[model samples]
Target: MSNPYFQFKQFTVWHDQCAMKVGTDGVLLGAWASVERARRILDIGTGTGLVALMLAQRSLPDAKIVALEIDEAAAGQARENVARSPWQERIEVVQADFKKYRSSDKFDVIVSNPPYFVDSLECPDRQRAAARHNDSLTYEELLEGVNRLLAADGLFTVVIPTDVVDRVKAIASMNKLYAIRQLNVITKPGGIPKRTLIAFSFSNRECVIEELLTELARHQYSEEYIALTREYYLNM
Candidate 1:
């Protein structure tokens, strides 16, 4: 099969120029985001337009989805991917950094699989490095931007490494965004938790946390994982 395309049950993602391909992180964020009744949605750092397309597929038919990508090549590929989707008319990909892109209207839902590897080693390619590093879009910048662009009741969802959850929570608190729901994901029964999928809102009520396991063993998927993503994953 084609290395550049990842075919889902409802949609297919074509990711040739993006530094990151269709991965578990993107899928987790897409499947985990709260799309119920959301009329407008934004996908920050939309590499390959995967999350945006997933949101489009999950949301109402009239929903408007916007995807923002910083890398030129990735943005071009994302545009192509979005245009070929059935929700093409409802989705638009913008070639602009999330920090520099200005939007007057606030979205009902905002999602991101942001680059949270702070102080990490840099890669050789400048674009890839920028996409992977926190230098181009810091956590502070992301939270501030979300604060500015998200509606009062809008939900912001993201996926990050488990180690970064505290830092992200602190940043979100500074911006007055509270973690309303969280899902901790592990690879297997006894493995270390690698990722955290979080949902934030402007409310300050007590937070709800949930633990989740993605796989039962190496290369073996769990029933919960399959159930959550069965609509998208073709094999499921």
Candidate 2:
């Protein structure tokens, strides 16, 4: 059986009750997102509140973070994880679908490691499938929510499979959210990029492109990857 919890440098995430557990994708999105000066943040489809906690640790002490999860079990576990973290007071876990969610106040930064499998076979486990497949939250719907809740200068960031990068960018453009930065995530030194991290904003700026090699070899992490995630990983 998988471990019930993942212990980070500053926080512990217990994911036994969550459909999706703490994994590299969530960690990468949480660590790679630029949260500098963000006074208010939102994490959509937060499975175990990992990204929310990480953002809380990175953002200003006065920053407030809201983690939205559609699944009841996952949202409850996220709340439990947040309650145990140092930033309990700063993070709020809300059980709600992002597409139908509403907020009076806009967010300075919005991040998500959303369900991206658009055409793949669904997992037999209904909850796991919803957490991984985009049927529960399509890119169009996700971007629509970001467009509605984002501040004028706010940024919406997400990590998705490389195959869907272009499609997502097109959708973002349709919503008037232009790509500002992108990071290609390669698993090994010579491997093809499997995921791309993108940040979108209201203004059309020159997109800054960068590459991140996660590992030099099997079990050997790259310096850049280690450096980016060292703050949260317990043994990095």
Candidate 3:
């Protein structure tokens, strides 16, 4: 694959060396993560620095964004992408596993498009498999890390397969993190939901569920989807 497999309006991501390339899930989480008033943000498993760059573009100018990736190759590619962005100074890519990384400061918002293919069939490539599977970072570890790193009023957002939403919610609840908002992402009008975008917080509030259809049919993007993603998507 070429260096830049994906290009946005203001930035281009080089994912040739990354096991995970730029994808819609990362774009959704990047644009969907609430960063309007957030001054400090953290992105876990930032594959190609897509989410961090999106947050940098969406958030305030002075917002400080940190991204963590375990794979050295992916982290290097992320660093390159961050350096090319306009908000380079405000964003930093750390080559470390989220479970072992520590910080004195708590983040106002934490977002992730984590590895959730637990107990599923494994792929041939070890790095790609690790990035997609739970062998390197488990749900428990991710939840615990979020609990430790998130501020009291902070919110944690993630994009996961709909099948795992219940299990993820259970794990998050065990750590006292509650879902405040959720969006079910479907490909078409009657198609089964493929992903769930969940926003959680420390406070226990009534969950607001919103069903979002990305497209009315194949190759047709919905108005709502375009509206939500217009800022970062070049063709939207």
Candidate 4:
């Protein structure tokens, strides 16, 4: 069986009960999203609460983080993971549908490693399918919630398949959100980028684009990836 938990430098995430397990996408979003000086953060579709915990670790001592999960089991596991972490006091795990979620307080930063598989054949497991497919939470719904809950100056960050980057950008544009920063993630040297990380804001800013290579060769991690994730990944 796959390991039920991922052991990070600062926390342990047990995901046996969650449909989604720990993965690099969540780590990338957690570590790469801009969190400097963020006093309040929201993590949408926090399947295992991985990103939320990472943000808590990166944020200031007084920062408050909310990890929203649509699945009850996943939320429970997230709560357990947060409870065991050193930053438990800084994180709250909420089980709610993001489309209907309401928060009186605006967030300084919002992040999600959202489902990206579009119209693909789904696996038999219903929970895993929900976690992996976009049917449960479309980019439209996700951005709508971001628009509603984000502070005027807050940034919304997401990691999605590079193929759909333009589509998402168009959706964000419709919502009056502009892409301010982007990071293309390549699997290896000279390999095509498969995933793109983007940070959007209500106010237009000059878009900054960068690239990250996960490896120089198979099983050999690149320096850029190591440096970006050194704080959370034990081996790095």
Candidate 5:
């Protein structure tokens, strides 16, 4: 079993009450996401407020960050976690289904490590099943929500299974969100990509495609990964 919480350099993410525990995917999205131009930020499906906290730690002190979650219990945990962090005043946790979530204000940057599995066996735990599967929040639904909340020049970013990269890119296109940057994540130098980190914007801008290797070998983290996450991970 995983631990009840994950300790980082600046904060702790308590996950005992959340369906999805802290993982590398969340860490990657949190560290890799660009908040340079973000004044207002939003995190969708923020299980334990990890990404929300990470962004706030790296962003300007005045940046407004919101963590949106559909699960009531998870949302409560997120709120508690954020309150314990240094960025409590900067990050807000909201319990609302992204599909029905409405905000009169638009966000400058939106990041998510959303449910990506479209075809997968359900976990015995219903809450985890909900957190892991895409049924509750389909790609189309996520894209629509992003399109609705994202400002014209704002960026919408996500990390998803590589198997569905093409399909997701197409859906983003349909939603009028163009792919602006992409990073294929692999386990090793020559390994096949397992996940794709993508960033989208409203304009038809030139897309920058790149590759990221997370590990040099089994149990050995790569330099690039260390550098990217050095500010957050305790041992990095």
Candidate 6:
């Protein structure tokens, strides 16, 4: 059985109520997102609040973050996890849909592991289906919401399947966001990229593409993956 909670060096995430548990996609984005200068950050679909907590550990002490989760139970669980963390005061878990969420303050950085399976079959579980499928939150709506709260020069980063990267980029461009950098992630050294870590901003420029190999061989973690997430994963 999967563990009910994920224990990080800095905090623990109890995901019993979350549709999505602690997974690699979330971990990669949380570790790869550039937040060195971020004063305020926002995490859409916070889930077990993993990304928000990771950002809290990465940013300065005074940096504040808001974690928005549409699922009420997951949001409550995120709040509880944050309350039990070291930076509880620096992070707030809000229960609301990102498209409907209103905030006067602008964010320096926005990140998400959004629902991307638009053409896939639905899962049996309602919550998991909502969490995994685009019906719960479409790319258009996600970008529109991001555009509304993101500062003119802020960075918006997300992780999506390699096949869907183009579609997501097209939507982001429509919303006036442009890609700046991307990290194509491969499961093994010789495999095709399975996911892409993309970073975008309002100001468009020459886009940069890079690759990250997660494993050198079967079940053997790659050096790059270990370096990126060493701070969080206990066994790393």
lDDT of 4 by residue, 5-118 (tens): 999998999999998899989999999999988999999999999999999987899999999999999999999999999998999999999988998999999999998788
Candidate 5 overall lDDT versus native: 0.93
lDDT of 3 by residue, 1-236 (tens): 35556888998888988998888899889878788689999999998999999999879889999989999999988999888889889999999988899999999999999997888999999999989998889889999999999999999999999999999999999999999999999888888888999999999999999988898887799999999999888899
Q: Given candidate 2, what's the lDDT at residue 224?
A: 95
Report the candidate with higher TM-score, 4 versus 6: 4
Question: Model 1: per-residue lDDT, tens digit, 1-236?
Answer: 44979999877888878888899999999988999999999999998999999899889989999999888999999989888889889999998978888887999999999986787778898877877888888889999999999999999999998999999999999999999999999989988888999999999988889888899888799998998898899999
lDDT (Cα atoms) of all candidates against the true structure: 0.91, 0.94, 0.91, 0.93, 0.93, 0.93
Q: Write the per-residue lDDT of candidate 5 for residues 148-226, one digit (tens) a residue.
A: 9999889999999999989999999999999989999998878899998999999998999998899998868999999
Residue 210, model 1, lDDT: 87
Best by lDDT: 2
What is the lDDT, from 0 to 100, of the residue 235 in candidate 3?
95
How far off is residue 9 in model 2, in Å? Answer: 0.6
TM-score for candidate 2, residues paired by index: 0.99
Worst 10 residues of 3 by lDDT: 1-10
lDDT score of residue 40 within candidate 3: 94
TM-score, per-candidate, Cα-based: 0.97, 0.99, 0.97, 0.98, 0.97, 0.98
lDDT of 6 at 123: 93
lDDT of 1 at 193: 83
Error of 2 at 217 (Å): 1.2
